[model samples]
Target: MKNTYKVNNPATGEFISEIEMNTKEEINLALKKGHNAFRKWSQVNAHERSDLLKKWMDNIQAHKAEIAELMTRENGKPIKESLGEVDYASSYIAWYAEEAKRTYGRTIPSHNESKRIVVTKQPVGLVAAITPWNFPAAMMTRKAAPALAAGCTFIVKPAEDTPLTTIRLIELAHEVGIPVDAIQYVIGEGKEIGEIFTNSEFVRKITFTGSTPVGKTLLKNSSDTIKHVTMELGGHAPLIIAEDADLDFAVSQTIASKFRNAGQTCVCANRILVHENVMDEFANKLTTEVTKLKVGNGLEEGVDIGPIINEKGYTKIIAQVNDAISKGAEVLVGNEYNANHQINTYFVYPTVLKNVQLDMKITQEETFGPVAPLISFKELEEAIEIANSTPYGLAAYFFTNNYKTGIFLHERLNFGIVGWNDGAPSAAHVPFGGMKESGLGREGGTEGIEPYLETKYLSIGDL
Candidate 1:
């Protein structure tokens, strides 16, 4: 018998609908079809591929309202944020469409007379993309757009909680002239589908955005075939407020960044480090700004923070907060949920904790919810030390008006992406990834298509 997965609304704790999971045989068939499609897709020129992507973008824009509602219902993000994500996702598709025609190659003069050398880029092959539930549509397009632009056939296994959005995405692809076999969507146990992706010889590359532990497992599995993998994994991003920073501006940006998407983002301010001289002022201003946010069902207008993804997420946040409290940290606003509340009622108040210790679990781990743990530092050196202490370094935010200090932090920070004055720094043209245990490879900018393309060198000599 085939397995099935059910969906739920975290805000109301209501069951949505059940969907059937693909079987092992179905996965294998999808792989075969994807491989077959690659043979044809790789033959299409870059301009034609660019044209197809433009149509896909138009489809997304035409259905933005429906897409945003579906995403809000499935992922529990505010409708406003959902619509914003749709715009973000479409921008990537449009970017890669233009980038496809600009895949440059070089011709070099051979050392030996009468010999010519040329290097060219081509699609790597079949690609498997595994995306998480947090930003289902955006992550899907982020990976899919590049792969398609590079002339590769691809398959997507979206998180079970948010498969509907991906299903709709594949529908748009087909409607916009993407070959049926060139893009496939399968929903099932991740282990079964992941094993096929990692072990299959036909699968040449895999891109996954999820936890570091799972990324390690996929890396280990892919080692057998030596397949190329791009892993955008876990992050414990830190935000630093220098003593010289504008207090009100820093506090407001912190609130916006920390609570966006209910802090489920990998790059959200997991640990906020404030200079000792301004710590008290920063904390007070941050608390006041956070309280202004309305937390409720995502469909309601002015609901800034939606419910936690599910019961597990709510429990995890509660446990992290309790652990910190036991270690002597104090709550500033948004206290823990009551113990009597049903597990199905999965909303955690948007929380901000003060007097946080670096050793506390909430500070060390990725608090994947709307909780900001503030830690104070006396000097710039101390602030940098505390920010770089964590093994994860995906992104960091620093607020400062001092030019020298801004350059110092920008250069010294170990993260892949850094925002000097801007709290929200994500862009389609900028490269994004992580350092240390955060993940591997980059996903955007001019180099975005590098993972999907393989280079070849050719030489000829004439008599």
Candidate 2:
């Protein structure tokens, strides 16, 4: 109901700017414009679309510094991380620009001598996306690039906490000779805007990256229209450390995976499973590395950990840590929250817990903060079992020197992505999504554009 949406620097709690909220009438008009634009945009040759996307990608790269600063301010990520995200985000557009030319269809052999069958992929029409705040720029480009490359008009409602980055990206698109109506962004209450997207007949496809519960609601809402939907939902990623794993390598990889974005990522190592043979060494080394991390304003030089998104995130992280402590998890390092810290109230110290039981809240829930809980397992099978216990199956990582063991874990892990010895597995060229309750569909690689395309079969008689 509010007319203006306030943007703030989560790291420093500084007022940034206010964005005008789109009214329902304006949103409806935009939808009409998007639909109309889709009719023409979808008719354009793939090569032209690819050129436009490449131009947009170049523009984003040219303004990388400005966008990264805005992203760090609004999204509460370190400036260096924000810059990396801009590169990651632009990579999608670059990839899709080339992939646009490769939307090849198939010609199926017909049983009947007089008939020929052909299959073609076409744009699914107007697409609506609701992206998360964690990786604001990357999430948008990951979805939008493929959709746009597939010749679908796009409209997005970015997370309220971080809309500026999305808005700026859209602006870059428009400046690069891309039509405004062909790609647009709306700012407002998520529920209200999302309902309009789900309920609208003109929106042929809906893509979202958020929580499982919200993805379910959107699935239900879009059922009436039977809209094509792609949901990249929640993840409770597991990182397993086998007995034969290189201790130093595993520790470094864990730090890269767990503490990136202050552990606010969907694929952050939520449950760390370590073999009993190396549990103490792993825990001690992990604790030492965590303690060495610099937590402060994201804009500050050499600051590795930044403030949590807001009070809700801050409270949730505290609750999860406290619950683990109450259930007999021993704090190896950083159980103390300095309430009197002058930097920011939402700042959570990087935490590590040893002797973490499987029943603890930290293991069951996605700890979206910089907290690592070490759970010891005696055997490889036990570690596998513990890692696969959760309902979420987005990503799983394991470190092992044995080739056979690595192959075994890779095949057995019930996740969309499996990292044999690596921590970060996501990229512009790999399919990324989750299984089970983690949500549906894939993004990136050759599979990324599939969701935005509709397959049509044609039969020619008397050929």
- Candidates in order, TM-scores: namely 0.98, 0.98
Error of 1 at 339 (Å): 8.1
Per-residue accuracy of model 2 over 90-187 as CA lDDT, tens digit each: 99999999999999999999999999999999999999999999999999999999999999999999999999999999999999899999999998
Model 1: residues with Cα > 4 Å off, grouped in runs: 338-343
Tell me the tens digit of each residue's lDDT in model 1 across 310-401.
77787889889999999999899987563324636577788889999977999888989999999988888888888898889899999999
Clashing pairs in 1: none
Model 2 Cα displacement at 411 (Å)?
A: 1.6
Q: Backbone clashes per model, in order? A: 0, 0
Candidate 1 positional error at 171, Å: 0.4
Model 2 RMSD in Å is: 1.5
lDDT of every model, 2 decimals: 0.90, 0.92
